[model samples]
Target: MSLNVLAVDDSRTMRDMLNLALSSAGFTAHLAEDGLHGLEVLSEIEPDVIITDINMPRMDGFGFIEALRSDDRWSRIPILVLTTESADELKAKARSAGATGWIVKPFDPAKLVKALQMVAG
Candidate 1:
């Protein structure tokens, strides 16, 4: 089955890159500017997985994950944080907020695809 993905990031370039990677790997990709936008997009699409950046203007990844986890309708969806930060504390925070996995920024296209498939499966 072709998995549907929601990619949330403030960076237009990052969103574009994610779109290219996900589409090339045979997944349908949806884009959102930030956490709030991600939530809005989430309501419209039943994404198999979600990929979000850590740092953002409106709402950060931690807030997004927390918000998503609070809702039973989307709590079980796999969320993978894509960011430049590799700090342990941030990862712990994300985990506590309900993230399924994490990927450092400048992500490898192949690895990103693999990570999504592994979690979404």
Candidate 2:
């Protein structure tokens, strides 16, 4: 099955890289510039998995996760935090906000694909 993915990040390069990696892995990928945009896209696409950056312009990953967890329709979907922050405190915070997993930035494409499949497939 081709798992659908929604990736929220402010970096264009990261979005492009994710698009390439996800498409190469046969996953349908959607990109959003920020958490608010991610929410807007969420209205249109039912993604099995979500990958989001911690820092963003409008709504941060914590807020985004909180919003999703509050919505029954989207609460159970797997969310992976992809960020440059490697601090344990941040990971705990993301977990508290309802993240399913964590991935430090400069992610490996193969590992990312594997993680998505393991969680969403």
All candidates' TM-scores?
A: 0.98, 0.98
Q: Against the hidden true structure, what lDDT does model 2 obtain?
A: 0.96
lDDT of every predicted structure (CA atoms): 0.95, 0.96
Give lDDT tens digits, candidate 1, residues 25-92. Answer: 99999999999999999989999999999899889999999999999999999999999999999999
Candidate 2, RMSD to the unseen true structure: 0.6
Question: Residues 50-88, candidate 2, lDDT per residue (tens digit)?
Answer: 999999999999999999999998999999999999999
Clashing pairs in model 2, backbone N/Cα/C closer than 3 A = none
Candidate 1, which ten residues in sequence have the lowest lDDT sum?
1-10
| Model 1 C-alpha lDDT versus the unseen true structure | 0.95
